[model samples]
Target: MKKRKVSVLGSTGSIGRQTLDVLSAFKEDFEVVGLAAGSNVQLLIEQIKEHKPRFVSVKDTELAQELKSTLSDHSIEIFCNDVGLEFISSSACDIVVNGLVGSMGLKPTISALSHGKRVAFANKETLVVAGGLIKNLLKRNKGEIIPLDSEHVAIHQCISGARESEIKRIILTASGGPFRTWKEQDIQKATKEEALKHPTWVMGPKITIDSATLMNKGLEIIEAMVLFELPVGKIDVFIHPQSIVHSAVEFVDGNIIAQLGATDMRLPVQYSLFYPQRRELPFNLFCDLLSVGKLEFEAPDFNKFPCLKLAYHAAKEGKSYPIVLNAANEIAVDMFLKEEIKFGDIPKIISSTMENHKPSEPSSLDEITELDARIRREVSERAKTSKI
Candidate 1:
């Protein structure tokens, strides 16, 4: 079999690093064609040295310069900004792993898909903000955008070879984060350390906070809407504390099919990359049922976790509200983590921003991105001025 060429954007992030690990196992089966990182030149330099990708890009110009100095003897090409998209579009890559954070992943995703590259997407924000536009592009270019998030990946795998009419509902399971059972007052007083302590997974700080607020699950709902092309009403979120069962899909015949495995990201990441083929992996055995006791489920308390409710509202509303909600939440979460706002204030800021947003029907990437930026700036100013 011929080796597939790959380019990993956000190569220094949590998902990016693990993707490299998976690719490392299939060295002869895969080639690293390009790499991109955000301000992490040290690790980027190390990755470039090892993978020897023909191209690399960094967000910071100073870090890009430093990398050039270090690899001066090597003929590795380095770029920033527009050059990054240039490299991604023209890459000798069969697959592009878009692991970028927030809405920044939009342009690179469009670039790669326009060139007919298969995309392994970890950037949920892109789909959340502009799923219609991206899907349209995929249709135009005859490209595929596969999910890298475990929940969406689970749904994709379970629904494979199954007709949409056969499926009744898509169920998304959530590990209710550190604040799962905390009282309202207690959650209101949660510290950064508390919010970051995810019960089931290790991820970036922003996502962890989203998990705490249940916004991550909310985002997943919107992601599923576009991915499966289903109505938001048909998608459901259940708080599954064990998280052993990644996600589930129910059929119209009353059969509930579910995907279960150890809580490891590489499982999903690998699945996205090599669909229809399962590879051997070295991971801990099944989470012992006896030790785990009973797996529990409950309806999410939307009153307490308003972020989740906001996500569903935005998704159901189906205008530009989801973009505004996502962008504002990203800014609010950053502020909360930086000690600029209290933990509970995260949702408050988002709600406030959503109130000010006038929803528009964005028909293209440019329009969606414009709305995203406007919400971010407005939310940032609101967050800075708010007494919370």
Candidate 2:
């Protein structure tokens, strides 16, 4: 078998690290051709040493300089900043695993697709903010997309051969985060520590906070629209505390098919890398349904998690509001992590940002990024005076 060439953006993050782990196990099946990371030069150096990718992208000039100084006998080419990431994305590869976080991930996906390479998309921000743009790109581009997130992967698996028109709705299962059972009043005062204790699925800090607020599931809702081209109304989010059923798709015929698995991200990661082909993984990695015993499902309470309601509104409002939603949420999550805001303030801040935003279609990537920056700045200013 010819080794599939792979490039990993955001090589230092949670998804990137897990992807490397999966790749290491299947060395005979794939080749790590390029790597990129944001400001984690030390970790990037270590990954470069192990994977020995032909190209590596560092966050900035200083980090790039540091990585160069750390280089030991590796004949690898290093690139820096955003353009460097674009270079890595467009480089020769079979698949580009865009594990990058935030709006920055969008460009790399576009770059990879323009170069006719398939994308294993894990970044929800890319779709949430630029779903329409991505749809236009796909119509003209040669590349294909395979979702890396568990929920989308589950839906993708269930809808593998099913016609799009036959689908009634797609149901996304949420673990309900760490605050699932916490009282509404208690949730307001929840600490970062309490929020990070995800009942299932280990993820990065931003996403974990989002999960805690149910905003991550909300973001996934918009992302589903981009990936599946389904209307927001046709999408449903169900609170599934077990985390076993990742997601489900209901057909017009009233048949509901779901993909159930353990809370392991590697399952989706491997699925993205090797789609339509299931690789052999250890039996222990498989889900134990008997041990799980029972799975429970409930409708998400918008009153408890207003961020979710905001996400749905943003998706429906559609123009630049989704951009505002993402930017505001990112800032809010950062503020929460920094102890500058209370748990409840996450949605409040996002709401304020969205309410103030004048929706406009982004004409270009620069506009998209500028809109994100503008919203972040406005949100940061609002957070200082926000009564959280």
Candidate 3:
């Protein structure tokens, strides 16, 4: 068995830590060739000592140099910023797992695909912002992009044995976050702590807030459309409070297939990293099926979750609209976290920013970046005078 060499971007994040957990369990089966993180130098140093990867990268140039001094005993190379991401892309590895959040995930993904390496993608923003470009790149390079997201993974598994033509709809499940049942009046009072208490999954702060707004599901809807080549109309969202069933696919033959397991990120991560083969792990067992009660589903009231509606509009409009939407959302979330804005103002800021932008069809990567900066600036300006 040839061991799989892995390069993990965002090595200090939730997905990155979970990826390490899987690698630890299957030590002989996988090798950590490179690791990258934002600014958690302490944790990165600890991970460096444990896995002893050949290369490491941090966001800050000075910090990266300092960390290199600390890891002097280990003969590992260090890099910072885009150069570091490029190193991971061109490294001698069989798989590049992109756990980096936000638009930063895009270039690394393109870099990996260009190098003909398999990508285990947890970064939904990449697909949301540049789905067509990445799909074309994958086709041209003859490489594969796999999903590490649980909902997408479940949909992949459910439709694996069936013909694509038989698919009727893809049903995506959302845990509805901590504010699912809160009244519109009460939602404005939701603090960062209240919003971060996700009912089912443990994720990063940006994504956790996205869940609260149901915008995560909205982004996943765009991701599903890109992954399966299905129309946005054919992709549906269901608010499943249990979250035990990851996702489902209903076929034209009246067969509805679903994937069920403990709400663990590792299962999907492992599945994508080792596709067409299943590895043995201490699996979570199902118990008391009847006592668990019934799984419930409800249509998402867009009136309550306007961010979701914004996502769908951005996705359908195409061009730079999604980029504007994502960039604005990132800025709004950052401001909300800093208490520079209110919880209710998050959507207002994003919406106002989107409304002011004039969408242009970005024909290349440079254009995308240009548009992203413009929207970020515009969004920041709008956030200052936001009435919400």
Which candidate gets the maximum lDDT versus the true structure?
2
Q: Which lDDT tens digits does candidate 1 get at residues 284-378?
A: 54557677778888889998899999999899898898898899889989988898888888888888777877778987877887888888888
lDDT measured at residue 181 in model 1 versus the true structure, 0 to 100: 89
Worst 10 residues of 3 by lDDT: 282-291
Better of 1 and 2 by lDDT: 2
What tens digits encode model 3's per-residue C-alpha lDDT throughout 266-335? 8888998899798877445443457667888888889889998998898788778888888988888888
TM per candidate: 0.96, 0.97, 0.96
lDDT for model 3 comes to 0.87
- Clashes within 3 Å, all models in order: 0, 0, 0
lDDT of 2 by residue, 131-227 (tens): 8778888899669899999999999999877767999999999989888887889998999999999988788888899999999988999999889
Ranking by lDDT: 2, 3, 1
Give the C-alpha miss distance for residue 127 in model 1, angstroms.
0.3
Better of 1 and 2 by TM-score: 2
Cα RMSDs, all models: 1.6, 1.4, 1.6
Scored by TM-score, the top model is: 2
Q: Candidate 1 clash total?
A: 0
